[model samples]
Target: MSLRTRFTEELKAAMRAGDSARVSTLRMITAKLKDTDIAARKAPTDPGVSEEQIVAMLRAMAKSRAESVALYRQGNREELAAKEEAEIAVIESFLPQQLDEAAMAAAIDAAVAETGAASIKDMGKVMAALKAKHAAVLDMAKAGPMVKARLGG
Candidate 1:
C-alpha cells in the first residue's frame, strides 16, 4: 500500500489502541503533509505530493526533532528531550530502512562515478544523482559533506 494509506490505517490503529503519543505524532505528520500538498496544489494540477516527497518531509521532521532533542538534553531538559525522542520513534515507523555507513559510502562512490564528478564543481551532479536514487533512505545532510570530501572540496 501507499505510504499515506498505511499512515491513515496506522492512525486508526493508534486511536483504537489509545496510544496518545503515537496518535499525536501521526496527526502532526498528516497535518504537515496536508499543508505541503495544499501549497503544491496552489500551482500544480496533480495530487501535489509523491510518496518520496512525503518520506523526505518525514525525514526532515525527524531530523529536526533529533537536533532539538540533543539541544534539550544539553540544556538539562531531559524530560523534553525524551518526549522528542518518543516523537522521533513514532515518526520513523513509516520511513524505509536507513542506509548505514557502508551503504552510504557505496552510494557516494556510485554517484560520483556515474556523474564523473572530478571536482567540487561537479558536487551538484553527484548530490543530484544520490538524491534521485536514495533520498528516502539516506541522510543527505550527513552524506553531503562526505560527497564533498570525496570530490576533494
Candidate 2:
C-alpha cells in the first residue's frame, strides 16, 4: 500500500479502536505532509513530494522527537519523554526496518565497491549510491561519518 493510503487506513482504525495517541500522531503526520506538498507546489511544473520525500520527512520527524525524548529525560520529564517515544514508534511504523550495524557496514561496503570509491573525494559518489539504494532503511547522518572513515577521510 502507498504510505498515504496506509496513513488513511491506520487513522481510521485508530479512530475506531479509540487509540487517541495514535490518532493524534497520524493526524500530525498528515498535516506535515500537506504542508510539505504545499511547499513543493511553489514550482509550477513540480509535482508535490514523492514517496521517498515523504519517507525522508517521516525520518526527520522521528529523529526530532528522539532528540526531544533525550532532552525531556535530561529535564526529568518522564511523561514528555514517553510521549515523544510513542510518537517515534508511530512514525517508524511506516518506515522500513532499519539496518543493524553489520548490515549497515555491508551496505556501505557494497556502495563503496559499486561506486569504485577509493578516496575521500569519492565520498559523495558512494554516499549518493547508498542513498539511491537505501534511503529508507539507512540513516544518512550515521552513514556519512562511516563512509568518510571508510574512504580514509
Candidate 3:
C-alpha cells in the first residue's frame, strides 16, 4: 500500500486504540504532508505532492528529530531526547526501506563508474545519479563525502 493509505488506516487505529503518543505523531506527519502538498502546488508539478516528495518530507522530519535528539542529549535532557527518538521512529515509518551499508557502497560504486567521475568536480554528476535512483534510500548528507572520496575530490 502507499504510505498515505497505510498512514490513514494507522491513524484511525491509533485513535481507536487510544494510543495518544502514536496518534499525535501520526497527526504531525499528516500535517507536514499537507504543508508539502500545498507547497508543491506552487511549483511546476502536480496539484499535490507525489510519493517521492512525501518520502523527502519524511526524511527531512527525521533529520530534524535527529538534530533535536542530539541537542537534548547535550543539554542532559534524557527524557526529551527519548521523546525525540520516539518521534524519529514514527517519522521513519513512511520512508522507503533504507539501503544497507553494503548496498549503498555498491550503488555508489556503480554511479561513480557510470559517470566516469574521476575528480571532485564530477560530484554533481554522481549526486544526480544517486538522487535519481536512491533518494529515498540513501542519506545524502552522509553519502556526499563518501562519493567525494571515491572521486578523489
Candidate 4:
C-alpha cells in the first residue's frame, strides 16, 4: 500500500484500539506530511510531493525524535526521553529496515567502486551514488564518517 494510505489506515486502527500514544504519533506524522505537501505546492501544476519525499520526511521526523531522546536523557528527564523514543518507534515503523554495520560497509564499498571514488575529494560523488541506491535504508550521518575513513581522509 502507499505510505499515505497505510498511515491513514493505521491511524484509524489506533483510534479504534484506544492506543492514545500511537494515535497521537500518527496524527503528528499526518500533520507534518500535510505541511510538507503544502510547502511543495509552489504552483497549481506541481505535484506536491513524491513517495520518496514522504519517506525522507519520515526519516527526518524519526531523526529529530532521536536527537530529542538524547537531549532529554542528558537532562535527566526519563519520562520525556521515553516519550521521544516511542515516537521514534512509531515513525520508524514506516521506514525501510536499516542496514546493519556489515551491510552498510558493503554498501559503502560498492558505492565507492561504482563511483570510482578513490579519495576524500570524491566523497561527494560516492555519497550521491549511495543516496541514489540506498536513500531509504542508509543512514548518511553514520555513512559519512565511514566513507571518509574508507577514502583515507
Candidate 5:
C-alpha cells in the first residue's frame, strides 16, 4: 500500500485499539500531510507530494519530538520527556529502518563515488545524491559532516 493509505489504515486501527498515544501521533501526521497537500494545490501543475515526501515529513516529525525529549529532560520534566520518547516510537514505526554505522559509511562512500564528488566543493552534489537515494533511512544531519570530511580530506 502507499504510505498515505497505510497511514490512514493505521490511524483507524489505532483508534479502534484505543491507543491514545498512537492515535494522536497518527492524527498529527495526517494533519500535516493534509496541510501539505492543501498548500501544494495552489500550484495546479505541481504534482502532489510523493511517498518519499511523506516519509520525509514523518522523519521531520520524529526529529521534532526528539528535540522536545532533550528539552524536557534538561528541564527535569521526566514525564514529559518520556511522553515525547513514546511519541517518537510511534512516529518511527512507519519509517524505514535506519542505517547503522557501517552501512551508513558504505552508503556515503557509494554516493560520493556515484556523484564523482572530488572535493568539498562537490559536497552538496554528493549529499543531494545520498538524500535522493536514502531519504527514508539516512540521517542527513550525521551524514552531512561525514560527507564533508570525506570530501575535504
Candidate 6:
C-alpha cells in the first residue's frame, strides 16, 4: 500500500483503539502531507509527494521530536521528554526498519564500490548512491563519519 493510504488506515485504527497520542501524531502527519501536496500542486503535472518524500518527511519530524526530547531532558522536564519520545515512536512506526551497524557498513561498502569512490573527494558520489538506495533506512548523520573513515579522510 502507498504510505498515504497506510497513514489514513492507521489513523482510523488509532482512533478506533482510542489511542490519543497516536491519533494526534497521525493527524499531524496528515496535516503536513496536505501542506506538501498543496505546495507540489504549483506544477500542474505534479502527482503530489512520493513515498520517498513521505518517509523523508516522517524522518524529519522524528528528528525534530528527538531534539525536543533532548532539550526537554536538559530542562529537567522528564514528562515532556517522554511525550516527545512517544510521538517519535508513533512517527517511526511508519518508517522502514533502520539498518543496524553491520548492515549499514555493508550498505556503505556497496555504495562505495558501486560509485568507485576512491578518496574523500568522492564522498559526495558515494553518499548520493547510498541516499538513492537506502534513504529510508540509513541514518545519514551516522553514516557520514563511517563513509569518511572508509574513504581515508
Query: CA RMSD for every model?
Result: 1.9, 1.8, 2.1, 1.3, 2.1, 1.4
Q: Candidates 3 and 4: which is better by lDDT?
A: 4
Per-model TM values vs. the true structure: 0.89, 0.91, 0.91, 0.94, 0.88, 0.93
Q: Point out the higher-scoring one by lDDT: 4 or 5.
A: 4
User: What is candidate 1's lDDT per residue for 72-134, written digit by digit as tens?
Assistant: 989999999999999999888889998999999999999999999999999999999998998
lDDT of each: 0.92, 0.94, 0.88, 0.95, 0.89, 0.94
Model 2, C-alpha of 120: deviation from truth (Å): 1.9
Writing each residue's lDDT as its tens digit, candidate 5 over 78-141 gives 9999988988898888899989989999999999999998999999899899988887889999
Question: Compared with the true structure, what per-residue lDDT tens digits does model 4 show for residues 1-153?
Answer: 999999999999999999999999999999999899999898878766889999999988988998898899999999999999999999999998989999999999999999998889999999999999999899999999999999999
lDDT of 6 by residue, 67-133 (tens): 9999999999999999999999999989999999999999999999999999999999999999999
Show where candidate 6 strays beyond 4 Å.
43-46
User: In angstroms, how far off is 2's CA in candidate 1?
Assistant: 1.0
User: Residue 59 error for model 2, in Å?
Assistant: 0.6
Can you tell me which runs of candidate 3 are displaced by over 4 Å? 42-47
TM-score of candidate 3 to 2 decimals: 0.91
User: Where does candidate 2 stray beyond 4 Å?
Assistant: 42-47
Ranked by lDDT from best down, the candidates are 4, 2, 6, 1, 5, 3
Pairs of residues clashing in candidate 2: none
Candidate 5: list runs displaced more than 4 Å: 43-47
lDDT tens digits, residue span 1-153, model 2: 889999999999999999999999999999999999998897778767999999999989999999999999999999999999999999999998889889999999999999999999999999999999998889899999999999999
Q: Candidate 4, which segments miss by more than 4 Å at Cα?
A: 45-47
lDDT for residue 68 in candidate 6, whole number 0-100: 93
- Clashing residue pairs in candidate 3 are none
Q: Which residue pairs in model 4 clash with each other?
A: none
